[model samples]
Target: MTIQWFPGHMTKARRQIEDKLKLIDVVIELLDARIPLSSRNPMVDEILKGKPRLVLLNKNDLADPKATAEWVQYFADQGLPAFPIDAATGTNVKEILPRVKQLWAHKIEAMLRKGINPRAIRALIVGIPNVGKSTLINQLAGKKIAATGDKPGVTKGQQWIKVGTEMDLLDTPGILWPKFEDQMVGMRLAATGAIKEELLHLDEIALFVIKYMVQHYGAGIQERFGVQDLPDDMDNIQEMVKVMEAIGRKRGCIVSGGKVDLDKTSLIIIRDLRAGKMGRISLEKPF
Candidate 1:
């Protein structure tokens, strides 16, 4: 099945962001640390042209540290200020405002040069679904100003929150593009819980993730689920199933007739990875 999610309200959210962009001085874009390239909304570039932007890699605790550093440099090389932060633990979240100020330094200085003391800075914060945008806001405010959940689409509308005396932050609903051009991108988003779980089958995405872990993180896969060995081939479904069955047997997800409960096994794998029970991993690395 081709996995995609573009609800009607997302269209409204995009228009709302576009309308507010005119009054905003800076835009903070949140991306999933595990899938930075896949989690970025393509519409942001067209709507936010000529605006100062700080790309935040949220959920850094769940991703590879080396890959996160590379991604930070990747964005920096492209002239986009990016930082890795864990919204849940407030890790490196303290540096967010300073970077925002750093990116908009020229504009902030220009206001002073003209003898015009700027008012509160208006920043539009945008991200794809379930990227910890709401949690990050709460971390910044040191209080819960926005609703948050593990599932996507928890924040249904927009609200202006006073982050500090000199800045007002606008939290918008997470908006997804109309289509996913690459199928792997869809899989990564779904596996990372950025997309709703109901939209895709956990069994299939778990297999995809297993294949990746087999090739790139074999030791992690073995250690997490207590699988004795990694699968031999990515294209061979039987070999993949063998590894999954071993994981299921280790977790006691077996039926009365001695058959492995694939659904239960897949869900355990998915939830474990999502909760970072597996070792530090990144689905894709910058080439």
Candidate 2:
């Protein structure tokens, strides 16, 4: 399936972030804990080049704890300080201030040499849409400094939120790359609600989620839906049908003819899974 999604504003946002990079000492980049590799914007590396970086695996509460640990290690292997955090509940947020200070030790030293006592380190919170950047900032700031919502593109412009005496956060609009080159990356984004629902095929994305879960997660579907194990030869669509039927029966999604409403059932399952109702699920393993 061809995935086409490039908003005109994203181009302007990219330019804006590049222009603002000079004003910050560090870049605190957030990636979805569930799909860190896919949710990461490739352009961030080039755009924020020469800046100290922190890779925050946001929404950790919704992801598998073991997988979250692996992702932190995977990023650390690349010489980046990564941490898993639950932005909504404020878990691990206390670590952010200290971590940012540690990551910017060189910059802090430089300021000390210049006689800037207790210099405030400026950090820009960067991430793709719906990755929980605003929520994280609010938690850090201890107030509603940035507007947040469930949908993508809630942040329209840049704003500075002072967290404490030593740290200030620049919140930027959620950005996506100009194009998604990989089909898997596109599907993962869709599955996590990063891509708008109107832009995706619900049934197709749900099937992808089901196939991945069955392969890597070991019987999550059978356990959750009380369905028999899928046949070894069963295809993704067939397995998805079984899952939909089970969910339809459980949720009472029946049509006039008493048949399970496949479309409605598919949407319900996808929504629940994305909303973390299906349990702590992670889409990719650390490489």
Question: What tens-digit string does per-residue lDDT give for candidate 2 at 161-231?
Answer: 78788898875543555235788888888888777766778777877877777677646666676666564
Error of 2 at 209 (Å): 1.3
Best by lDDT: 1
lDDT of each: 0.81, 0.78
Candidate 2 residue pairs that clash:
none
Output the lDDT of residue 213, model 1: 89
* Model 1 / residue 57 / CA error / Å: 0.3
Candidate 2 lDDT trough over 10 residues, lowest sum:
171-180
lDDT of candidate model 1 versus the reference: 0.81
In model 2, where do residues sit more than 4 Å from their true spots?
Answer: 1-8, 146-159, 171-179, 234-236
Task: Please provide, for model 1 over 54-159, each residue's C-alpha lDDT reduced to its tens digit, 9 standing for 90 to 100.
Answer: 8999899999999999999999899898989899999998787788877777877999999998777778777876787778878777886635433496755556
Model 1: residues with Cα > 4 Å off, grouped in runs: 1-10, 146-159, 171-181
After superposition on all C-alphas, the RMSD of every candidate to the true structure, in Å, is: 4.7, 4.7
